[model samples]
Target: MLAALILLSVGIIEIQAGGTPICPTITTPDWGEVSCSNENNVGSRCNLSCQAYFDLVGTTGDAIETSCGFDGMWSTATEFECVPIKCFPEQVSPENGEVICSANNFAQSVCVFFCKEHFDMVGLSAANNAHAICKDDGDGDEIGQWVSSDGSTDFQHPFPPQCQPIRCPTTMEAPLNGQVICSNRDYSGSYCVLFCRDGFKFANRKEKIVFSSCSKEDGHDSVGEWSMPDAPSCRQCTRAEEVQLVALIHESEGDRGQYQVATSMIAKVLTILRRRHGINPTLRVNRYSSSVDASNEVFTTAFTLKSSKREIDAIPYPGKGANTTTALRYMDQRLTGDRSAKIAFIFTNELRDFDAEMEMKARNLVEREVSLFVFTLPQKNRARTWIREQLVKITRDDTRVYALPRMRFTNKYKDEVAAKINDITMTKGCDFLI
Candidate 1:
């Protein structure tokens, strides 16, 4: 072999007298593609690859290549044909729900969805049309995909059915003079619990509570609804008792309009107490001022509840001064009694001090069991929010305090304000939702 050696390139081998395979032309499968390098002749290997979501028939891998044999034949059992991929038996189903398919998630299979108790199929509107189809993935990938049948294509990602907890219609809420509670107020299978404040009971004296529950019955859209007999209302059972209310109007330079509203609402309260609740409520309206003379006279008493409204002139005075300190001291000395409900309504626009003496005077009011309701301006004035904070500390119970724009004290919100005062008489406070 060394006698006639010709070195054409590095690592070249000597010529031998053996013949290589010359295979025929190879064809590509309908589901795949085939590619060959170096003319597809002697010892050439051809590649076989499937389309998207498709696999080769009777093959364990897609990366393998087809070879040519010495008999001029392509590789055996290496068919380049690809078939559609198979999909789910369980992975495609929704949690707390199920899906039954006609063809078991194979190509051309149809799936119908269902939900377990206390659950709902959220993806579909009605069970009649709750179905999906398994076919070629539309995105150029011939793989199987679940397609919605409701004509709505938008889904979380690839569009599959889903299940969620059923919710009840929002028709009932907390009742007046009582409270309504539930394990889950917004869902089905939730039981409602009702409770009335002291001295109150349901209209049906025999039954303390009505049977109320969220059910999966014939609710609007088959979602869920409250049971037939809704939660009953509560009524005042105990007789109305006497209440002595003292209104302290803290008049300032520009608080005339606010002064007028305070007196007006107080008048409305007197009328409501006498006419509606049959309570012989006594009221005394007084103004607190810081004038030198006011300290001696100590803010002259304006008016007191009378057998007739004509007996007292309910006039709005143009007073000047906001000495709550002086007023509190005077009230501490004046408000002496063992009356059950001694209410003090203080209408002020500002707080003069946060000193210990001032706080002690306010604490005296609370220690004497005086229910103090303080009304002031809204918090639009960032500088004056301290007034509400200071008053809250004095009242001890912030619910007894009310703050709004002075002009809002009109009859438009009479029932609302009156109901709050009414609850005070009950001694149980207001419900969660007024």
Candidate 2:
């Protein structure tokens, strides 16, 4: 009775027990790791993470984690797992080539590479023994890489094979009065384009009207062989009528060498025009100067078509000038009248003004159907920018203008300059002069 009275005074009776807490033992997910806060006990939390190249799914919160609630259960339960990352199939191949993957980019997949028609593979893979492998190497990394067939590693990044264009051998030679340029030295599908020098045309009438390309035949093996039968040739082209040419040479302060070169090249052009094309070409030498009395005079009058070298040598050189404005104005005046299809070649160093007046002169020259080819010689004055911008605006055709670097008086360079001049003239011919 006394014990009962004590229990009643205490309000209730109690019993003690001992064991582990009733917490769920969460299993680790595939390709993922799991860790728990306090062994997943009540009020404890659990966190998950995926291995390399794998991503966690299901939970959208800041972390892949959940807490054990008071109900003795996990607060979050879903199909949370890790997924492997797959690369795009097209990424396996470089441009102009194709790739064949083994299993659509799944783990342990392989890929074989090949080039299209008229192309050949480069590097070790070209020997038909190498391929790309999709392997994890058991290092917890799931990225695959390219490997050689002899168990040798190729590109560190497992890249695709290189496929280069195949072209036939170079059999086309430069025509006598023309030039031939090929896109490739030796392979298939390469092209060779032909171009005739000035006052010249393709020897064949059919070829003169239509330009042809030298190309390799399809399926032709790259054994260093020529597929085209014969190369193109060029001959002296007869003008529809006589064409006249007037040269306005520049004789600046330090351009004595260039002045000499101009005289020599001009003589060559005149001789070629008269002898080859049977045209009576006229030449007028002039200079630029800043002197108050500097006149844009025609130092040599309209000479005979086949002007002698001595005749060209006798022409006096004009003194230096501040700019070529005066000479340009002079050229504009002389380009007038029944000189149909007449071409004017102006050699100058600088442009003093690109004003409205200059534009009108350029327009006048163009109206007379005159082809104005302006040649700018090199100058040491680096601070002064050339008037190329102004010339483009004036002529409205920038292609008709040309610029030359500092004079290199080698025969080769001189010939090249002459060839360029002729090329431009033949391609952009003037009309029949009355």
Scored by lDDT, the top model is: 1
Model 2 has how many clashing residue pairs?
11
Report per-prediction Cα RMSD to one decimal.
Answer: 13.4, 15.8
The stretch of ten residues in a row with the least summed lDDT in candidate 2 is 1-10
Instruction: Give all TM-scores, in the order shown.
Output: 0.39, 0.37
Candidate 2 structure quality by residue, lDDT tens digits, 1-434: 01111133524322112322233566777887777777665677888677654646554332377787644457777236676645444336757778777766765556777777666666544565446655444333334443454455645323566766765444567677778777754455556677667666665444443333434343323333455446556666544333446667765575566665666556655555556544454445555465323244443334553445455455566565554555566666665456234567766667765578777777777777666767666666454455687877665677756665544432324444344445444443322211
Highest-scoring model, TM-score = 1
Clashes of each: 0, 11
- Model 1, which residues run further than 4 Å from truth? 1-197, 200-241, 291-320, 333-336, 377-386, 428-434
lDDT of 1 by residue, 217-244 (tens): 5422546877744566777654324455
lDDT of 2 at 55: 49
Q: Give me the overall lDDT of model 1.
A: 0.61
The per-model lDDT (C-alpha) reads 0.61, 0.56
